[model samples]
Target: MTTLFELFSRQHVYMQEESAPGFAPACLMRVNPDDWGRIAEAARTENCRWVAAWGEDRGDELSVNACFEKEGAYAIARTGVPRAKPVLPSHSPYYAAADRPERHIRDMFGIAFTGHPDTRRWTRHQAWKEGEHPLRREFPADGHPPVPTAPDEHYPFLHAQGGGVYEIPVGPVHAGIIEPGHFRFQAVGETILNLEERLGYTHKGIEKIAEGRDAMALARLAGRVSGDSTVAHAWAACQAMEKAAGMEIPERAEFLRAIMAERERIANHLGDIGAICNDVSFTFAFYQFGRLREVWQRVNHEAYGHRFMMDCIIPGGVTSDMGDQVTVAMEKQITFLRTELEGLYNIIDDLPSLEDRLDTTGYLNPDTARAFGALGYVGRASGMAFDVRKDSPYAPYNRFSMEVPVYQQGDVATRVKVRAEEILASCFLMEKLIDELPAGQIRRDWRIPPSGAEGLGFTEGFRGEIMTYVRFGDNGRIARFFPRDPSWLTWPTLEKCIRDNIVPDFPVCNKSINGSYSGHDL
Candidate 1:
């Protein structure tokens, strides 16, 4: 496999002599503004995945950063432009995944993307005026006491014009307690011709509010990015902070973090499996999985302090240690869960009615999956064989073996099967973590890093790869923080997968993907 440096060097792109401070198995390059698109084109030629892109507002200029990964190696390319007329060529032309993120950067930082296909506002909507960019330093965190804005009914959505095509507009608000996002569909009869999503209704200005916070405060904030992925988010943020501070946590702490992450993965997979079943009217599997999830979460509460295991991962390490009694309880619970899941899976796999509904619904071809760089089970189900734990191991994961379940069917049934297999894989890993529990301090003392320290962190969340970038400002406060959730990549693929499927099958297709609204909105 080619290294990141070799790939860039072969393309004749200039690399900085001194790399950025805190990335491992990854490097940072400060490229000229003119070389930005060239760098993206080079990565695309190498079949690298475009991970994320965001902008930082300096006093006089704006800096844009984009990350790419190839063969377990990561490279961050950054460039700056004048704040007065912040314009940079778009990378979206090379990578489809960069489309919405670049639009988001334009909306948040007032940095224009030259040659971007769709220049309409993404995260902005009607939240702020056209000229106002909330992420700039001059903008207040409270947004000038926040006035109520009128409804955004005039935003243009793509229209399909044909003999029989008509529109179906779904929620920015819905009947359920889920977050707000609008889905616009153009359909002929029951078959969908096209689908477009309008998200960011739950935009919380997370990046703006993250400024100036200390490490601990930031950890707490990261945990709330998506309530369901609390453990994964917190672990990624803390890993970034710890790297910037140049601190090495205890071995025991690493194991504890992995254990919590695996448990979080299992709980979410169980819940998602149940939700998918419910969408297909498979009430038996739905209730069974729901009961299993409740029991799993209760076990989390008994061992950790929270049902979601929030606030348990701090900067230096984790907050709590697992005692012998807690380990015993967890091990016993794992055994019970595994046996029960086997029975449930056997019944669901044999049910012909459930099979008929899910067999080929919501098909996402492998080519589309690769083009969008989808992640987690969504990508795995469609035969994208990239998993952070096995491909880019870290800490406790590096110490043990991992199995990533992948399938090529790319349908609702395949997605459900991937999740089921992953639950079993997580169970195996959690058992190893418990069996090899180390004895030491759970956390170390956190130290303040010098100003201008930068760090990048990556964790394979239950959904997929979670990448976080952090740069420390004066007095060890956060200068810039960006956490790229896996949902950012998966949400767009949902639109592609739903095409040509019936409108009524949308629910199961959606549940099978299960993109997190808050995770993507942030």
Candidate 2:
């Protein structure tokens, strides 16, 4: 296997490792815009995972940054195009995960990614005019009054050519209170021939609002990036800011962050397991799991004052600390949760209806999962073994034993099993963390970084790898902030997995995957 460093150096890519102010070292490659395609392809050929890709308008020119991970380290490939031209080749041909993001860049920054297949507008469907690029610094944060969005029905979708072929168009607005997204399915009779999605209905102009905000403001906004993944996003944002500021948080804070993260993970998994079962009309597990989740959230509210732990993580450290009473109470809850979860699993494991609904439904092969860059439970179930906690160790995560439950089945059942196992693992880990809760200040005083300082935050959210990039400007303001949620990568893979399955099974498959619309929309 060729190391990413050796591969890039072999091609004389003009790359050098730049140490982040207080975090991991990142290899920064300076390449011509024309050569970006070739270098990006080479990186992918060497088995590198695409972490994120974004574009920034820099006065006279536009700069594009592509981040990749290999062997527990990160490398950034960068290039610039003339502002007037703003054109560069796309990396989507080599890395599928780059497709949507590149299109988003084209929509927002007017940076044309040449050679991109299916270059139709994504993320910006009538949100702006043809030539208007929202993230170009000049666009007002609060744009002109909202205009009625044109009907998105004209968007081209692949047609299934056959006598029995028909198209089923699901919601950009659903009956349930879930976030809006359009899903198009081409099917022959009951069997699905294809699945395609058009997301971004909930785009909140997050990246636009992030500009010029201070560290605390940025962290607060990051928590709202995706409601369910709030803790993960805030922590990642703060990590990047702290690194840029050269700030160090206390050991106790790191442990507390981990505990909060694990709790978040467990809560989501429990809800998902129930929801997936309920999609098959197995309301028993749904009620039981919902009960458990309610109790869990009550505790979160009592202990952290937030049901989802929002705003708990801040730059330089956490916002608060836990007392011995909370620790003892949390331990008791964990013990009870473990006993209840085991009993529930035993019954669920014996149910034939669940087995039928889950066993081989919505199968996403390992090869497909790998190509699509699936993450967290979705990737682990399909045998794509990559977990940020284990592979890219950070803080207290590196200090603990991380057991990533992997299953090769690649079906709804396998995904559910992985979630269940993870919940159990989180329970045990939480117990360990509380038992060994060290004594130290939860936060540390810190100074903001000078202009041009940059850092990146990588964390394993419940959904999977989340990357938050931060750069400070003059007067402690943010120059650029990009939070790449794992949902961006996982959502595309949903289309591939649903093929050949019947239309009725779609809900169960979707619930099992449960990619975040808001997370991906941003």
Candidate 3:
């Protein structure tokens, strides 16, 4: 559990351009260029996981930053390349989760990861030309030249076949009101041998859309990244911006933000547990949980001004203020939710069929969970207790009591139990926050962060750890903003978890480990 600075200071590794910023206690370690592989190897051996990667545009160059963290230590590795030739070493060989984001950066900024396994276009559609990158400073947003005629072609997909090993292609479009992402399954009979995911079809060009936006506008965009995680995402984005710009927020604002975040957690987990029950055809559990979730979100809208609390968090502080009336109402709702959840848990735990169906199904070993850098409930369910709020405390979370639940079962049933436990924990936290709600202003003036400086914000969202990496330019505009949604790691875990499970049971397993396609695509 040694810090990155200590590891370098102890000469276990070499570091360059190290800076200790006065604001937040973070070690700005500049990774030496030639030793990337060695560093990657050491990071893996030391259990350090990849945090995120982002590229900031200079006049003629792109500055790429790859960040890694373990315990409480964070290291940011910087590399730059000419705008004309944006190429760098790929970390896919070392970290499996690096593949999608690497490909995404390539698609957005035309940055190339030389050894990336799958180099096909990720987010670029027919809107842009071959060499054009949307995130580049000079890239035009409107009135581009007409695209030349290239014959319409089908997307190339990996094929698998060996007698019983056949392919099953699922949706880019599904039957339900869900986001689009294609799933290619290679299975032997009902047992999945391999699964390849094709995501990003719903890419809203959020980064592209956020250009030239003010801090408030950016907060709205951040909340919309994944609708279910509005509070956490907006809070995280503002946390980074507020820290970077040296803004001070009121204590009341911080507490309100935490309450909103915890409520979001409770609602999402309730929905997930219900959905998992529905997936397993347990009608009673599904209906009961769904009713509770519906009531919960309604209370959120009434108390927070938005159903999802979108734009509730801004740069300097929170946008929404909670009065005593709303606080009292929330406590009442929480009381009802606690009673309902206890009853539901009692019934669910007593159902032998439900227990048998979920137990040992869709297992993800601890090693695989850590190797993939899984986060949140899924990670916690598999013995990875890396909650950003607790592991890397921020704002109101630091002032409050927190307990992160962990389970070592690493199966569908274990994931369910962990999520249920988290739901109860969130209720306790929300109640405490309401009771001890501070009194003060909710918003403060915000200034743009100075140029050429980088900072990362991490939050424990309803799903897991949501990491945002940002770098500002001289013009007081964002040079690069890379958000690493927990969905990216968790989605792959689903593929691994479905291995020995039957095709019919896939629905239950999938629902239990739901990962957002839109969030990951971004």
The candidate maximizing TM-score is: 1
Backbone clash tally for model 2? 0
Q: Kindly give the stretch of ten consecutive residues in candidate 1 with the minimal lDDT sum.
A: 15-24
Pull out the clashing pairs in model 3: none
lDDT of 2 by residue, 1-522 (tens): 554667777766556555445446666667777788987878876788887898887788888999888877777778889878888988999989999999999999999888899779998887678899999978998877577777667788777787988999999899999999999999998999999998988999999889999998999999999999999999999989988888788999999999999999999999999999999999999999999999998899988999999999988789879997888889999989999998999999999988988899999999889887899999999997788889888888888878999989999999999999999989988988888878989988767899988888989999999998888889999989899999999998889889999999999999888999998887
Give the poorly placed runs of model 2, Cα more than 4 Å off: 1-3, 11-23
Q: What digit string (tens of lDDT, one per residue) describes model 3 on residues 211-313?
A: 6666677778888889899888888788777767767788998888898898889888888888898888898888998899889888878877778878878
Best by lDDT: 1
**CA lDDT, every model vs. true structure:** 0.91, 0.88, 0.78
TM-score of 1: 0.99
Alpha-carbon RMSD of each model: 1.0, 1.4, 2.5
- What TM-score would every model get versus the actual structure? 0.99, 0.98, 0.93
Worst 10 residues of 2 by lDDT: 14-23
Q: In candidate 1, which residue ranges exceed 4 Å CA deviation?
A: none
Please report the TM-score between candidate 3 and the true structure.
0.93
Count: clashes, candidate 1: 0
Clashes per candidate, residues 3 or more apart or on different chains: 0, 0, 0
